[model samples]
Target: MTQTQNTTHGGPDALGVPAWDFSSNANACGPCPTALAAVQQADASLYPDPTYAALREAIAAFHAVDAGRIVLAGSASEFIGRVSAWTAREGGRRAWWPAQAYGDYAQAAQAWRLERTDDPAQADLAWLCEPASPLGGAEQQAHQVVGSALQVVLDRAYEPLRLRGVCSLDPVAQNHVWQLWTPNKALGLTGVRGAYAIAPEHALTEARALEQLAPSWPLGAHAVAMLDAWLSSAAQDWLTHSLPTLREWKRELCAMLEDLGWTVTPSDANFFCATPPHRLNAMALRSHGVKLRDATSLGLPGQFRLSAQAPEAQVALRRALIAQKERVA
Candidate 1:
């Protein structure tokens, strides 16, 4: 049975594509030309190396870590589930994550029947993300937990797309937690579905165990190509260049929402949550060819999470909201 049938996400929905989609935090300026070319040229007919030897080495070099620390996954969500399952298998009873975080963290814990706890000190496993999802803010108590013996997974999916602010964790602290990297969002290639985790410096044994849980060839050829391209100078440069445009668009988005009487939440990343002057009817907006991510599933009800978009799309969203209000009036 599929657990995701009820899972809430912000991209294209059952109604098809939205004219203006702000449901996801993907880089609005991409699909990166370099990464796209690599995916297009991927050798789909041939199987990727069962061990992914060269790919793992490249990723290790990119992060300047030992190859043994690189644990490949089909995607970020897949890794979340894998690690949660690993914790459960190893006799872990409790898991902790930020009050508001990507739903998969909770979903995986639930699937593995791990009890949820509010206190990280009491938890056998913990999850943290920064420039966090929905809020696009820092993870509370990150520094303390990162260095502790508690098994921690630090989702760095949005770090590359950070428009403002610096990571609170220093390099030394970062080496103590499992650093999960999903470059698809930064490259604006979310559809590619590739991700990896740099295990803590002393977690080689844990990393090997997690690898055992994975199926052979967990990442397909397209995913391999996408990740391989993700490490290239061209793709990295393109991603770096996209951030300023995203930052400008984020400013415009926040300004536009504020002008419309929405209460915008401050964030350091490319997205933020805003509460409309009145209750938001997401379906009504969807009918108007606009799709916004309702933060209800992300534990922030009555608010919407919007990723930065180009000016034209922003204008379209502005128009739609105004039109909706006028029709109601």
Candidate 2:
């Protein structure tokens, strides 16, 4: 079966794109004006620099890291596969990740034939996602694995959108694990697929190995523009300003869900998991152009994840839920 068939995700288009989508955890206040303008101005007619020298430099400067430490990928999913393959090539035989996480981690490990292990110390490679997917909470045992000899990659996709709490790792701890970043989600431009990883400090050999595995020109002009724009003062400012709004929206959304008899879990990011008092006909809701991510694939059965969206979207969701209930009645 194809990958789509094998794995389910929040932002599926098979049911037609939802009008009030609460499935994807993208910034509700974005695409940031500056970032969107940059993407629009991208000169798609010409091929981006084959080596992505300038792109790498822009990303490196944003993260305050050496240019050599920046490894580009088409997207987070692409990086997961490439990195898993790299681990396999380097004689990695076992992988460990949170019981709840982005599905690509497991899919990549399985594709590379790495045995799955629950214990982080026993695994050749470990994956950690702070403000993790579905749950939007801190990674468990994150502090214990820091500075370990075992290869670890910390997915920081949600770090930019974090509304509360700090990352578990300090600067010294952060230097030991690969920091994977995808700016599109935070930019509210998830369609613009591009991502990068900051290699562990002093790991020039591992950095070169990842680069060699990457296909030529992994990032196209638009992606390059998005990543570059992501570093702009205006873009950063916009993101910083949007957090308060998202925090308010998240508060109201959670309260509304709780009123509807759903148990809302606390989260650090702009999304949270909830279990309704009654089983929901998610497909029925989707037919009405309202979509919520089923958390089952993320190891939380009978619960759904909803991204913090505009007030109007929340109203639409409440109406849709009530309508679905009426239809079932």
Each prediction's total of clashing residue pairs, residues at least 3 apart in sequence or on different chains, is 0, 0
Off by over 4 Å in 1: 1-7, 147-149
TM-score of each: 0.97, 0.96
| Model 2: residues with Cα > 4 Å off, grouped in runs | 1-7, 147-149
Predicted structure 2, TM vs. truth:
0.96
| lDDT tens per residue, model 2, 159-246 | 9999999998888889989999999999999999999999999987899899999999899999999999998999999999999999
Residue-wise C-alpha lDDT for candidate 1, range 201-228, written one tens digit per residue:
9999999999999988999999999999
Error (Å) of candidate 1 at residue 78 is 0.7
lDDT of each: 0.90, 0.89
Report how far off residue 105 is in candidate 1 (Å): 0.6
What lDDT does model 2 reach?
0.89
Go through the candidates in order and give the C-alpha RMSD of each one to the true structure. 2.4, 2.2
